[model samples]
Target: MDATTMADAILAALGGAGNVRGVTHCATRVRVDPAESARVDVTALARIPGVLAAQVVGDRVQIVVGPGRVEAVSGAVRRGAGSATAPAHRGRLSARTVGVLVDVFTPLLPAFVAGGLLTALHNVLAGPGVFGDTAVIDTLTWLRGPVALVGLVGAAVFALLPVLLGFSAAGRFGGSPYLGAAMGAALVAAPGLTADSALPAIHLTPETGWVIAGVDVLAIDYQGTVVPIIAICFVLARLERFFARRTSGSARLLLVPLLTLLTTGLLAFLVLGPALRFLGDAAAQGMEWLYTGAGVLGGALVGAVYSPLVVTGLHQGLIAIELGLLSTGGSFIFPIAAAANVAQAAASLAVWLCARRGTRLRALAATATAPAALGIAEPAMFGVTLRLRVPFLIAVGATAVSAALLAAWRVEAVTLGAAGLLGFASIAPGSVGPFLACLAVSMLLSFGGTLAWARWRRRRGRPIDGEDPRRSGDETAILSPVAGRRVAVESLADQAFAASALGPTAAVAPESGLITAPVAGTVSAVAATAHAYGITTDGGTEVLVHIGIDTVRLNGDGFRPLVRAGDRVAAGDPLARADLDAIVAAELDPVVLTIVTEAGARTFAPIDGETRVVAGTPVLGPVGSPENI
Candidate 1:
């Protein structure tokens, strides 16, 4: 699908643009903070043509559109959301602060996480007894410098976090980002002073410093600390903007910097600095109390809420607590987090099992669950479990049990990669066995629970989230082969699909790479280019599904045809997975044409334009025919 179409579909799935409080994107997912998380339709979102998955973290909606496309996708979504949505009604001061915090921190997670992981690695390599009783530069002395360089590179990112956060905060706060960077650099350079004479016991001496307001200045280093740095930058940016509007060019530049620094410095030293530090420390203390006093119950609570925190972007804030945990002892959060992810993935897999065979729902669920097991749970979480609600609760319930067990057994990871399979190796040296056991137990519980729930729903004749609609044996329905926006074939710029040469054709702007079988019939022909499929319907209608314009020239570059000629398949069966990005990159229109190729089919069933649908919804066939039944 075109970026605009995908954007439209995404916004619609997110309960229209009005539900969005804030929207942003990283490499793979377009993250949106929804005004009402309940309104979001995750099942519909997963079936959107190009959407790889959808997840809700806290109140945020993360639509995974795959790599390299989110920049355009997010831009489109932002434009549409901005135009359609009203100003956000921020209810509380804390909620407003959190929104700003998420905005400032969301863009920097990759760098921040990389630094944390590197720090953990450094601890593993250089902490006690590495040479095991051999003192002076023994076995691996030659590797010392290179390993030190590895630590240095990672440390550089940590040390300079203040500058990055400052820049992001300024941009978000509507000020010149470079000014924010300069202010941050100043904070780093002025590393706070101590007063020895007035507060004599600590052996620190007072020095001449610029006292802003009544407070004496001591510039403490802001390395690896974001909350304080962002606060300072927010104030600095506003100050700069306030100055900029009142002054002109050259004087504006110089005076703005001078005044901003002076005022913000004073505020930092007198207020925001101490306040943010206290908040950080208090947060650490609270987390400490929770872990120490609450024990297994604390672990249960953390596991239950962790994924929600991740989605809301609040989990990024807890990163500080994780770092603190590392500094104090081992981190217990990682195991619980792993359990939550693994259990959710298991729940999604169970949903796939309960889905009817040979349906688009089954194919998508199967495709979405694997990434979760590998630690990318957004797809399975948003695309499957949480999308259905029941599975999500089941997964969370299983997580509490597993996390409680983890707490009792004292499982911890020395590092921060909390993905399901990969996280196993990150456990603190001897805790791997218990960790795996908890994981196994959690997965089985969630999986068994999901299956039981799905069957119960079926027995009661309740609408199963993944169930296919019942169809008659002689039904002649032409369901949509791809999830996307419907466009009349006549509206094509090239008009090739609608030419007099071709009969009864329609076009779809597909948002997904996967193309499904549109009719229950035999595969009449699979085009050599793999850009088209010919299927003869069970009612003797031969249909041609041509993927895109000029797609044949790409010579099957990113197209994976999953079925072969003469294969008997039901409607919603997987036919192929087309790389929509590759098609766009090659400068081809990713419009799919579904034509009734039989000799004298004069007309198709009535279909409307501007319609968005999943892969199995009715698009063409006997619905409009005289002998429709």
Candidate 2:
């Protein structure tokens, strides 16, 4: 896409260009500063042709587009955002998005591992110079091209490291995403470290654990590995915030940059460098044990909790496992985790296909399916499957079963690219069949189980609570939009009520035929005829509910009441009965009118007339408007 189109597309993927205040990109991802951090649209970004996935790390919005496309995406973001200053609005990275990022991006981590391995391989093969002589020994050396290519391709993942984690971390902290990537790049520069360093080193003094070359190891390649760079960026973001708040003069702007660099640079030496090695080793070992011991069970457990982990913003901790495992040769956690992801997708897709939902719901399911299938389970877990109980179980069952199979068959993945069919290519040729079988079992079992459970619930005319009741709290309790009818006070239609305005509104029916209430409290005056009442729920804002609009001409002719003035009612409460046929005969629309009577209640918008609403349910809000009642 052209710069403008790309910028617009990326911004829209992050929720909207209007939400993005600033933008930057690196080799593989774009960083964004959205108006509201929670507003980032993970699915949309994942669906973008050039974009692989999206992550919110810290305060930045990171859009992964791969290495080559980073420059274009970043350029587009900068051009689109213009030169706007950071807004006061701040948001934290969502755990679900984080899961998506870790799953999607980490799968590719093997590429980095492969590159290092390949580079090592090249040194091993080229040492004898057999290719030049075509001797018997050189025959084996003929494979050098392929090996080098593999390693190069793998190394390329790290070449663009600044873009990947930079954007990912930025999204977490809610800062300038591109800036984070840029900062990461700076740590890997020539002057930053010696030639042989693997990552940046932290030192208390020159006498500390000796350097690789003249420069401190901390100033070296902080690429591919996790933790150190992330820590550095995190510290920098906080320091930036502190400076922004404390300094005010023109020199304040200069000081912000200066202090940020000094503080982060020092932190890199004192902490990030040393801490990463320890963290990476721990993550690596933990994943190794989980994979070896639990095998498929481990994967299933991880999959089941993966979505929740994303919500809690702790998924980042898992990255250490992948890094550590790759460095050590292999990790069971990484492979099984990939399998679990596929199981989740299978379960989600089964629900989407078997359940008869509306277009919107179907679309959401469809959108989440592909990514989940590809081993990116966040969208599926958060948007589609975890919304209910059965789907979650389906995902867990599939993952566990498949993971078990993989462990039993001793399937080994040699590369990475997510957990779906495409990712399967990474498995060693010897293990491919077993891995495939495991995946098949996972998908079939999970999908079939979810579908059967959903159907059974439908036949019984009862709702399946799904995986967890607490998580799916009162989803069925939304108010009905029916204008008239005296249904049971508490039917399956009414779900649990909460404590907020949007929570629950409980009231009894005044009349029998059809009950409606002046749901809000802002309303002060009813029509002159008293056919309806006014309500104000928006703290001080008010709204006027003139039942049937012009029906005010009826002058309470055909209405009856239940509870009178000073009574509190909730959604679905029976307020007053209205003769619908009479109103229709009077040429008035029977549809209940929810007029935006409050002037300041801009945040409250109608949720499409098609939605079923119940009486006393608070739909629109911000009471006490001067123009209302």
Candidate 3:
């Protein structure tokens, strides 16, 4: 597909460039940070030609196209967006915060991932088995050089994180990026300051160890720190802007950097550093305590909210908590995440099956559902479940259940990887069985539950579509096709058939799979799925025999036709053999609608709900009959 056109569609679907705050592309996705992420048309983007999947992740609308093409798409979007800026629309405060967070950290993620991968790879290759204990790796002298080299490469990226953060944060805050980077580098380059080193403390707490109440908060090194550096940059940006407005010319530039750095550096070192560290540590500790103390309840809670976190992009902040947990032992986050992600994926799969054949939604769902099996659930969640509303909630409930089960088994992940099927590799070897079981149960529950709920909803009888519900003063009758139990048209799930807009109708729940002619007529139309058939009666009445709701999506599977369109058939002649079990397996509603297309009719119901009924049953009495009412 042409990247330019695709980019145009992407931008359009994102509510135009005026709605966009930032536009960037990751390796495999085009990320459009929007002022109100909710306004971006995720389903529309998914339907756009060449788009793999589209979702709003946090405050950004992310479109997943493949790798090489994403760059082209990003460039096209930039050129297309031109000078437009995001409008000052008052959106949800939390979403706006998440958007800002996404903007700040998205650019720096490659470096973070590089650092993480290097650490994980070294642990696997030299220190121990990828998923097992390894102390012997420490004694392998030959491996030390290579492992150290890899570790250094990885650590080098993370070691200067503050500098990069300063640059990005400065630019975001409208200050000079270079100057901000210089100030950030200064925190590290300061003489006698070492990364993660303890500061000279006045006193230490016996319970929590270091307490700001007694000790200096800035005593620890700032190397590889996130929250503190962010705080420092926040202060530095305001200082830089303050100095810029008061000074003039080259002198302004000179003094702005000097005085801004001086004031902010002092503030950071003395105030922001200490305060942020304490807060960050407290938050991390709180997470640890909750996961340990509450166990299954904690897992269920986490599982329930984690997807929402992912949606808002707040999940990125969990990197610190996850790393902290991983370093100490195993992380409980991954297993829970697997349940949430896969359940969402399963929900999407259910939607896919329920969509009609060759529909754009079905095609989009195919692309959307594929990546979710590997832990990429944004497409499925945003494009499918979240769009539908009900499916996502079902997925959430299933996620909670699955995660609770994982917690019951005390499952934990030793390392981080894809959080769907591939995540099994990350689970501790001893917990693999439980993890797999959790995944299977969650998927089945999510998929089956969605289908059942959706079918039930459809059957609950929504308002009539198009035509009026009232019958004419005079009425006609329509015959029932193959049936076990005859039900009223109003009792049918499909509003169109239920309202008898075409005329009166009857719903039949088939006992045998056999579909038979309701009245002697020429076969007019037979759906490709073979689930629907139309016939014109000898009396010139147009009768439609539609079997199952959304079963047409099955595309003729499990349906065997005895006769085709244009064939003459008598009442009770075999029409088709449907696989009822397959229909249920596919999560389709099996109720059949037999409607009169032209002549007015009224329905008659069997006194018993499950009474035996069959083809040619006069579900609708003839026009003007007392039974017609």
Candidate 4:
């Protein structure tokens, strides 16, 4: 469906734009911070044909659609917010560029985790005399070999991610990605040291280093490294285009790229590289001061803020924090970070435990939890916790608790990369036991906390089986025609006449029916196409019931109408008889719905799966609630 239609539907379902506090999305889901989470119709959201899932996290409610849904969802969200209040658009990259980020990060998550874990394990296996026995050594040889192989491969990709990003960004910026990536590769390959050398070997060694401009620039290996080269490559692509208009062919290529490489590479080796290294060291020192000066407070804050860092993709920059803790035995950030990572999964587990039965919320929570346990919270933070409230808070609480314990234990780490629970290996051997204990405590706190809260809310907020307390005298009842799972009552798609079917959206069939009123109301508007009608129920609930998309073209020719605008229809009174064959012949789906048009009414959802329904049965709302607002 077009964004406008979706937005209109959401606005109607939400009762009005005023009910929404704000809305946003990260990579995949639409997050809505509602004025009242209780007012949201979970059942109606689930029934939205375009929506996959709906959940609440903290103060925000998230709607999960798939990839590429962001733009449409964003548009819809903006429209839902209001046509007049256009928010600033963001993201340094376009949809396609962001898409590449998702692709690169998601598919490679498992490999990155496995590589980190195996490398850590290899370190353990080769320690002291554990594998000194001939049989053990022989058996583990192949394991380390493969581990090394995979680790190297994974490391290469992670290191070169910037290059991949550059390539993708180049395409978005209207340059050739292939050529741009090639340019980046060229700089990395320029007169580097031997394959085994940790540092690149220049034509002149340090003893014989040649001067560039005035300063001596040393050659350094770029392989399996993150530096400024990728940034320079993009700059070169733009320079190439700019110079191409003035200069021709190879000269444009040679001068621009060559000049870019020489300038950037030299500056990196002579300036930026040392600067970054110094900055990293400085950051390490600051982390040390925090650990030493503030003690547990620092750790708690770090843990609390880590998940949000990951959200902005700036978490990778925290490598210095972990390295600092590793280099200085005085800190606990590494162990605490690891524990917090695991805590996210623990929180998800809590959410799963507390979710109502048969909502599919549990299944999604389970999927996100596994990745979190492995030190990859993207799937969890972005997929699940971002959606569910209890889970997010549980993670935060766990992180704080775990970090405090880690600080108290004075846990220290020595290795790099995210290894979650197994990151325990990186901790100083003497501190391992304490770190593990902290992790366990964190996980328990997270799980128990979330479960406790979710259970309390669920029990306390149980809806009445037959009616809503918010609706009392003069409240109208919008009943379901067919007894089935309640779907969304939203706006109609502009491309389809049913945009007003469910309300502003079309209601999905829980079963078959000759659509009728769920509430007795007056007809507000009738489509000239004769496929749909708008009604204002006696209780002042405005509603729309559309037969199908483009069915207006059929012009009652295929539909038998029982009522028109201004007609007073009672609950269960048939409004139209649909010609099953003509509808099929017209190349349209036969789904029909009765929608609430007026704002501010109470809404309810179906119990579970499609249930046997009937006209006059309670379907959506009892009226005079947020659904009608």
Best-fitting candidate, scored by TM-score: 4
Model 2: residues with Cα > 4 Å off, grouped in runs: 1-178, 187-234, 272-277, 290-338, 347-397, 413-419, 422-433, 445-629
lDDT by residue (1-629, candidate 2, tens digit) is 65567678777766666777776443234667678887787777767766655667557776755433555567667656653332222112342334334433433333333443444344334333223433222566667677667556644555556446665675566555655676767655534333335554532443344444343554334555445666666677777766766687887867877777777666665566556655545544554566666755655555455444433324445665666656766545555666666777777777677544443335556766765665556556655565553587677766766766766676665544455655555566667677777778878888888878867865653223211221121121123323333222234121211111221122222222464444323224333233544444424433334344345345455555433333333333444666767777876544444333333424333232323334544344322322122
Compare the candidates by lDDT and give the number of the best one: 1
lDDT of 4 by residue, 175-272 (tens): 55665566446545544432324654544443565566554434433443333433444455565555544566778766765554555455555665
The segments of candidate 3 whose C-alpha lies over 4 angstroms from its true place after superposition are: 1-89, 109-120, 131-144, 186-215, 218-227, 292-295, 304-402, 412-430, 439-629
Worst 10 residues of 3 by lDDT: 463-472
- lDDT of candidate 2 vs native? 0.52
- List the candidates' TM-scores in order: 0.42, 0.43, 0.41, 0.45
Could you give me the TM-score of model 2 versus the true structure?
0.43
Question: How do these models rank on TM-score, best leading?
Answer: 4, 2, 1, 3
RMSD of each: 17.3, 19.1, 20.8, 17.8
- Candidate 1 CA-lDDT value: 0.68
